[model samples]
Target: MRTILFAALSAAVSTSALAQAEDPNLWLEDIEGQRAIAQVKQWNAATEASLTTMPGFEERRARALKLLNDPNQIATPDEVMGDLVANHWVDADHKRGLWRVSPLSAYLAGKPVWRTLIDVDALGKAEGKSWVWHGANCLPPEYQRCLVSLSPGGSDADVVREFDLAAGKFVEGGFTVPESKNSVTWADRDTLLVAMAEGEGTVTRSGYARIVKEWKRGTPWSAATKVAEASESDIGISPFAVMDGDIRRVAISRNVGFYAARVSMRAPDGHWVELPIPETAIFDAVVSGQAIARLVESLGQLKPGSVVAFDIAQMLSGQKPEPALVMEPTKSQAIEEVAATDNVLWVKALDDVSGKLFALRRQPDGSWSSKAMPLLDHSTVHIAGTADKQDIAFAAVEGMLSPTTLMSVDSTGKAATIQALPAQFDASKFSVDQRFATSKDGTRVPYFLVRRKGDSRPTGALIHAYGGFRAAQTPTYLTAQPYRSGPLGLFWVEQGGAFVLANIRGGGEYGPAWHQAALREKRQNSFDDLEAVARDLIRTGVARKDGVAISGRSNGGVLVGAAMTQHPELYSAVIAGSPLLDMKRYSHLLAGASWVDEYGDPDKPGDWAFLSNYSPYQNVRPGVRYPPTFFYLSTKDDRVHPGHARKMAARLSADGNRIYFHEYMEGGHSVGADRSEDAMRAALLWAFLTKEIGSGAD
Candidate 1:
């Protein structure tokens, strides 16, 4: 199964061969090899022993677990399934989480009667597998029949099983696809569109499905008809369906690169009609017969920051549809989200790092009109869910200090609070402020600073950032772990330390221009921006120069690793989780080849020249004194290989630098499989931070 998926990867390039020949720690890249597993287990034991004995470890763990398992935590709606709304719930009772549904009418009336559809913990117990819920793709109209995805060991590769909602169980011998990093879309009642690792030449070099097939019910997997096929070098290809009142179009999306895609709609004559969309633009969902797209570069009359739409009917008939302007943001703004609900389009935009929501509708004159929806000012707003046939949508709003509140918005832009979470942490004693830090190149970067009110003394600070990817860093209330924006916020701030969220370059905080400024060759700007934030904190008296710590995960892991190696004295400690460290061998790792557009191809000499400078695995000097670092990883993380953290930790330890390494057995890329594990990781992190820099409770 794995061989067919990664067969094409080994033939890639000359840079990998050279790097492998030079690196002595390549043995740790063997992921499941006996020797590598033994090393990881030993390191995990030592790290746990060292961190668990820190001051207030058990107390902090218990407190974190309590907040994480709080029964009153907000239950954010996952999807609008006909008359019922689905949600994946986690708590002390349901540790593995539960895929359940509540009546939509009752949910809107503030009295939801939930019914359990899938108890993940029970299912795992019965099957003796570490199953993680990966959501469902239910057929539209009735939403009774669905394709449920469950990932074993919480990895991205998941098994798709056809489920019967009315029967409350998996269909006996129904449509089922084996585990792989794949996609299954509902084409109709008896037919489905799937893209999975089937056989040799079917999977891309990036370990994704290169071919999309149409599979009919009661047919063998071999009998599926080919819908579309992308190049083996491209990222991958997947099929999706767009359904409005009378508009239903099934399209295949060919991901040419990490930041680019080519979309083609299937015509009634069984031919693919390609859309004239630029690769840089994102092909969003079609709503009310309009195929919407967000531009990353200027397209004809549409600006880089504009949202454009095309008539799906015109495109299907082999006619080039005139681009219709949906919404255009200012230089200070970025389009955060664009969701559709049949007749209504819900857009969430960020202005100066603060969120604002708008409800857009297609006027009778073939143009779009938008109305500003009232929400919490200076807070983060996200589209929680949108009904398939209704004109209403759900928005989750929260801030650095404010608890999260779920709001319901109607077609006319009227908003109402559906449910509000009670304060889990004492925000009254703390204050939130937005500040700007100037980078080395004089670029103004924005960040959110949270600290105790009236406390001006220098204290230990934790600065978190993800400077790669166009993902924007927004503010959220100090909530539970697993949530990216404000993970462990309460745990850190309650210790009397200031919590800082640095909105550095290489992010969509401003727009495409901001992210493009830090692309591959100019990636140093992101690290410089991070360093500037640390200096700004010290200069503003918010933190002691020697008491500042940097934390990031995944792409941010790259940031943390780069920061510590590039400027050892700037940060007191580092928390790097599930990172990509060996830039030279990154493309050869699982799913790493797909991210070449974001980080650049290490195979190319020109790309490697710039990559070699910041690549943490290559840049770490043996005698250079570095800050104490905590490196966490998951053996099941197929996206960003565990070898990254493993090799980096081994190298740092061999060099006599303080390194704490922990590799979780499950949890894929997230590092925490469930709430219990999330709480434990948070506790361990805070314990390590408290040891490195005094917990500012003095």
Candidate 2:
């Protein structure tokens, strides 16, 4: 498991060897070592005792949990199983959540009568496993059977089970795959295309399934027919099934790397045909007779980031196919989503980080034409559900000033709001604005400001960002723990505090070009972009100089850690969660090697030179006047080892820096399985920020 470490360590230079020799906190990376656990307990107890007793901790925790567990909260529409809409929900009464369905008629009545398909809590308790629902994919036409995915303890790997949706039970003697980053799709009612971790040495260097197998009804996976295999140097293969009414196609996607794929589709007479598509293209589906794709690279005359369509029949038969442009994005625009309905292909684009939708349809002369679909201004429209049999598709609309509203649309591009959630916060007192900050390289970075509606500058500001992995920070109404953009607005903005979302380089806000510019060696641009945003807010007097704080989690956590270590005087407080601080050893951690495609292989000489200089753990000095910092992580964060947070906090404290830290007992990468735990974390985060960013500097 972590074979990349051997290769990376073999290339370690004298400087890296010396850095490790001098590092005293290496013992913290032992993960489950007894001494490490003891240190974690000491830090957890110390931080919780003070943070939990804050002035508004109780109120904030109660409010966040209330919203999370409220039964009235919008039941986000997922799939169209039958004449009913399916959803997965968790509330105060149901901790593990309920996978339920509501008839379209009942749903339209504004009081959906939900019928429980499976009570996950009950299922988990009976099985004695902490089962977190990943998702389900059912057989088409008659979606009576489904392949259900459940994560144990909320890691990336998940156990898959075949279930009888109509019977509302796990299918006896049906397909059941043991957890190891499993991927299973329905090839038919009695057959499945699966790629999973099976025999010894069967996983990729990135710790994913290397083999694709075809499993038939009533046969054990061990006895299944082998279909394909991904090389040890490649990131594992995944099975893709696309349905176009009566025509169904099954393709095995061999991921050459994180960003490239070579797709081979099963042909008419049970043979495989390699579609000559750009490796960076996403095979959406066969719309009519054409195979449509959202390209990360240009295909023929189609520009990168544009949706294009090509003849599927010709390509499947190993013939050259011409590409026709579906939707081309302007420089300020970015492709958000590409989805297919029964009769049309829908492309969702972000114009200046706002939302817009377009429909691509085939003309009478065999060419394609696109029309701007009517959608509400200033809101994001997410394709929620679609069926090949029905022309109507579902989308969820949300914005900074709006709660999520489920919308239904027909083939004519007409949309209607089927369900709407009442605003959670009082929008009358707050206003939303977008501003751009020029970075050190003269790159203009966008940031969203959500604060009180007044001419006066905000007394305090909390700037948040995640400028890695090409994950864009878009404005939407959400009350979740991790992506707390909306929660920050609800919890902090309403309290007379300012919230800013920075769209820095290394993100997909502007497009792939924005992200590509900040990858690997040029990763410093992301930090520079973030610093520019903070400086702009303060210089413009929108945020108090002494009352400015920064926060992020995962990759974003590294961003906060870097900012605090590199420029401590600029920030008053820092909240770094489940971060990758020690880049020198990051590749050795769980799932860290997989990200070498995003952040270059540290074993390489060129990559190590830059990574060593940018790593936060190595940069934190004994005399650095760092801001007050709070670090948080789950004891079982298997994705990013909790050691990163542990060692950083320990080193900071050893240097006499004001450090606050908490390590939850369980919860994998997310750090909280239930809202109760999530709310407590949120309370502590807000409390720590409030404590560090005190009265206004003005």
Candidate 3:
């Protein structure tokens, strides 16, 4: 039976892939595969009458299908870009407002520009439109703003907009160039470092790129010249600068394990000097005087086990100084964030087991003193943190039951509230708890479980997990609170339902080490961690296996997909949003090549063997009893190709599984159609969850 089912699904997928061949892009092919899969699943379902259906399932599914198909539900390219900027940033200023960028465009006098701006105040309240601000640097003065103005409508060309806060309006100053392919950072008001693709290759194969050229402020549009190039096999140019008294030294980083090259002014001429640091996937670095501090993940290693501060100042002066290991790895702790000022090295140690934050300061004598800071234990989760010599500011999200607050701690050991949500949000009835589940490896993963206070009915549960990319899934006090509160009147809480956030291994919650445990070759560790969490909940009688539902987006979508395929018995329903199902082709897809360091290059012989072991799309078996699932993808998602979700759903549906597929034509990577449309999507999702997980509206 399983063989028969598999054959049918494969046949459908092949037909769909062929239909989509009109678009040569791999994305079109994936979409076609999805259509075929859906057809197969539907045919199979027609033959099976034993599949259970929830009350109002057909009606709710119809409504969802209609909302997804409605033209008004789709977001324009501009709206999609705005959502991307808003959710991508963790800094205080970036999180507080709604951000929008014009579609990609070019200015004739200026360089190809993408108008990137943010309105500092509009979030959550507005449907589609948020607060708006033109080109301006949010950071303090002396920082250069690399602004791009997108041409009206979606265009390939853009006018690079350079704005000096000191002078105001967008100026025609600076060199012109094609649209950027990588992130651009500003160094001072005059120089800009942009990432340009110099080469390409297959998804799992290696490639090359150069970081050459520095666009100096006031320089003519045509004068851009090569400043540096990445070595062969290295694909990125990370631009950084260090300020020392009156001089500024520019640094360029390259390779899989980012090695540093320092360019400093030496009287008549400046020369480039390479710094010595072990080969590792360096995320970021800070250079000051003779000291170079970096956050590095050792090559082929999971966690950034060492925080090294090397004295390259003496090296620049023709002397060699030994590098100091400022912070060494502990059993379960890894460096989360680090900064150096004066002579002290301030580091944040993320304790994996407790999901707690620890502050460690290296004194002038090089001794480390560590203290545990109060966990921002509200419904609002911690998004990002910034630190300097005198103080540190961390942004956190409280749930819809609580206001999002930005808190700070000064050198004086005094903690102060810097900012709070401006809109009135009620947080009286909800409570949040951070708990741990033991994974198969004996690794305890932390999770934040939230529900209404005094609601102990042991009702259904919604378990969410995103354990990839070393991204931390913190708490947020937003619409989730209201949704959990029985807003649709489904009343999961009233039914005694609870929400569980599984902090599986592949996340930053436990610092880099936690992420390393689940990356690439050890990818199965994440799945094991997630499965353990589900079992723990069941074993503890907190929630029954049949009463639970799972949801995730992007990498999290991969998590859900894996769960559905591998352990369908654990969940009654699954929602995979904007998921990357075809791991085999992920790296070759849009912007996927850049993530090789995270997911491993699929092209390599060794890596391919490991990646294929869990490639969700390739591993889907025929005739397997999978849970009912709702799949969503956006047509405008230029990031993770929507074909993953579309094809996966189609395949499952065609295989006779209860599946619902919704494709939003214009929502980009984040699947919300528009402002109002997004809210409606949220409503539909909640509605689907309640119908699937909640008991009748008693």
Score each candidate by Cα lDDT. Answer: 0.84, 0.78, 0.52
Estimated TM-score for each candidate: 0.96, 0.94, 0.72
**Candidate numbers, best TM-score first, in rank order:** 1, 2, 3
**Candidate 2's residue-wise lDDT over 580-654, tens digit each?**
888877876766777888888888988999887778998898787799888888876767878889889888888
lDDT of 3 by residue, 1-698 (tens): 00000000010123346635632233334443565445435533542222214444345444433432332211112211111211122122333323333221211111222343433444223424222222222222233333533221111122334543234334564444444333344555556765454334211122323555666767763566766665544544545554332355555665442222333322214676666554453423343444534445553232355666555566666655666555665776655555433333445555543333445554566445656556454333342444332334343435434555555544334555544545332345556677778888898777766666776555567777889876666554433332221132223443456777777878877666677788778888888888887787777766665777777888887788887778878888787777888787776555456567778888898898988778777677778878878666565455576667655765676678877655555445655434333434444555567656664221
Number of the top candidate by lDDT? 1
Candidates sorted by lDDT, best first: 1, 2, 3
Best by TM-score: 1
> In candidate 3, where is summed lDDT lowest over 10 consecutive residues?
1-10
lDDT of 1: 0.84
User: Clashes per prediction?
Assistant: 0, 0, 60
2 versus 3: better lDDT goes to: 2
